[model samples]
Target: MKSRKAFGKLLQKYLEGKCSESERQLVEQWYELIDEAPRQDYTEKEWEALEYKLWRKIESESFETADESIESSKLGFWRTYRTGIAASVALLIGAGVWWYLGNQDTNPATIATQPTQSEIAIQDNTSSKPIKIDLEDGSTVTLSPHSQLQYPNHFAANKREVQLRGEALFEVSKDPEKPFYVITNEVVTKVLGTSFYVRSVDATKKIEVEVITGKVSVYEKEKVNNENPGVVLTPNHKVTFFTVEKHFITGLVEKPLPQIKSISKKPETFEFDDAPIGEVLNKLERVYGIDIELENDKLSTCPLTADITQQPLYTKLDIICATINGKYEVKGTTILISGKGCE
Candidate 1:
């Protein structure tokens, strides 16, 4: 192994994007060594100091050590300053452990959390159609190809938690006391009972959850310590967590259907005769549990006379907009309506 002083210098240069190819290779190898080595502990103060030093080095873009004598004997420099490098090694090992653990396996279903010995791991590597998995609590999961699910054979008394990788459509049974949790690489999706589609795309470094029914709460794993309530999504709403960026973007699904069918009473046939546009939109929003934003207040004067309760949401919007000589656009889960006012 290279002396800690030399390795640190190399790493600093690499972080500053100034290292030679050979130096970069050496730094990578050293990182591998640190990860494989057993962890060493440091006092809080020592760890803080080490982090401060690392940040200082990284931020000093034009740094160049003036110790030419130390560079000459790079391999043996640590022997002469054995005590100095030893102290640094302790911090390096700890930091290495942190980085390795954070990145080990991003597939939350299989790699994020360790389950008790009693839990079961279900995996599907075949490229065929989706696999249907029935949970103990009468819920069902349709797992896509190359996906894996880690769940208890029988949910514990407290909660029903499951981990997932790749894509899956979940149909959770209603249990107010025991919330159903789906842990993906980017976010933890929780719900009392609902159907949703979760997709973790490694290529895009994103995790997406689109709700088909009920409501869901999504929050970052890192934010669990804080009091952040995160975001709650109702039916037809969706959230995308960018793993690389560590942020979320909320939006609507491609086609939203009425979510109250199974839970609420049968909806009245969507029939309207000279109905105010605002009233018509209110009904559609209620049926889909989505937000409808009227961009033009003038649209209120445009009464709609159409029956579209049975049609798809987009189709319904198209017909209504056509009748009023207006247009509707979906922006981030909300429908925006604009048009020329009726005389």
Candidate 2:
């Protein structure tokens, strides 16, 4: 019996297109056997009934296998477990079983040399709508209208890289060794794990990156060869690069808000029940990485009770303000709240 580690290694290599013909066949045989396992004990009569059904279906086929009896048995086995096997295969691939389980000693240079064969592309045509692309590494990109994204079918062992044109939002999966890179015409954004937005508009001939959560590093690709390290951005900060000036300007994103999927904390639900407005704003600042200022200090004493969960940052603000007889405004990405004092 092949050890579990060895079997996982073999499966990984096959998925990476690095296995020899014999190794590929061996993996396929193992997969067949795994798929053929029966879920329930069957009597002879039950087996006969299954065989009869399979044969009835096969009678209409024009092609016949030379090993008729053996092929029929394989067909019967497949019919019993095909759905379960398909789901298991999808789960394994999504979980990066190969990368996680395989020996990690492969030379990075050699892995880089592996030719990329498959590329996947996604696009959005309307500015009013956006689309999301799930990458093999468990990261996701939300492409804005009039945008195009191209990525490889399988990531290189040493890095996860993709190309973007136009605008998009990225929620990257964390992998310390295999850094993620988003390359565009004007700038390249790199990070281990974070969420951010990138917009490269041709009319303006500039590229913009807004850090929504975590940290990101953005550099002009042309300047990197000259040893320019570029700028590192923390949450709520943004960097814009002008093609004409060949320079960058750092600022903040409009309407910065918390990224729900990334944060893992207890009582973290956006739900509020007569929570102190000050406490609510603090949590918002922490989650969204944006600063909030209470123009009227007395607003701090006010309490808000609402289930603003799942609402957009602005919507939640709207609800809170409406309840408190207050108002909020965006001033260069900072939320300033002003309201009548609550007695």
Candidate 3:
């Protein structure tokens, strides 16, 4: 390691874009060393004092006595470099203080928290078909073509985090104590043992998260500490984060599927004879884990006789609405039915 004063001068020259190629590389290496160092909690004043003490210690350890004539020559060199050396020391200290403070002052809720010391493994899918990457924690990631995923070899005790670029489907394992976090450039999706699809390819485009099972929490990375921590989406629901607009839009997925837990327990017989519309809607809600609301309370009393087990959810809704002379519209994750009750 170079002496503090010498390193500071080189760093200052690099900042001003005056360093040669070799000097530039050397400064970058130093920066990487600083970045890889373990973080510590230190106030600005304390950091300054530490920096001073650290440099003094380094100087003392590396110090060497010189002959009187050599010392006189070195003193002459210092006289010429004094001003530049002072500015360099100040610049380096300022940068160190800024980095220490910035790292310590982050939101606890931020999904892109500091990574663990464990080695990270990256999976890049270059093939046309999606590739499945199994994690050590029993979770799996289906990385789409041209996409990449960076995950640790072993999850930390407190949380599981992964970085995604492009599109991927995450089937997280159940660990209530250690929630899973998927971080994209624009948004973060947090979950506890859920299956969800995330698409965040281009920064200029939109980032989307659609839940297949369980629940997911999606939020802007910059607004983690805000009163509104983004959108919480349940099964069949999705949230889209528009990068340019910096906002989220929540809605239902295009082709919503019945929740696995609900369907696996028992087979659903969508055959109903003279069943109340409310009862029918209630069954649909439970099956798909979606919300269905009626505009008129009386609409729920309308009788419906239909065999909808063979039809898709929307088609079944269409038949039910047509039978009662009603219409349905999707508002966010909920389906709304409006009609003047059956006469």
Top candidate on lDDT is 3
Give one digit per residue, the lDDT tens place, for model 1 in 28-114.
543342333222333334445555654454334224354545554663453334434344544553434332232334443532344
Q: Go through the candidates in order and give the clash count of each.
A: 1, 0, 0
lDDT of 3 by residue, 292-335 (tens): 99998888989999898878889999999997798999998789
As for candidate 1, its clashing pairs are 109-164
The best-first sequence of candidates by TM-score reads 3, 1, 2
The most accurate candidate by TM-score is 3
Alpha-carbon shift of residue 95 in model 1 (angstroms): 27
Model 2 ranges off by over 4 Å: 1-160, 168-173, 211-213, 225-229, 234-238, 245-257, 260-274, 305-307, 322-326
What C-alpha lDDT does candidate 2 achieve relative to the native structure? 0.68
Better of 1 and 2 by lDDT: 1
Candidate 2 at residue 343, lDDT? 54
Clashing pairs in 3: none
Supply the TM-score for candidate 3: 0.66
Q: State the weakest 10-residue window (summed lDDT) of model 2.
A: 109-118
TM-score of each: 0.65, 0.49, 0.66
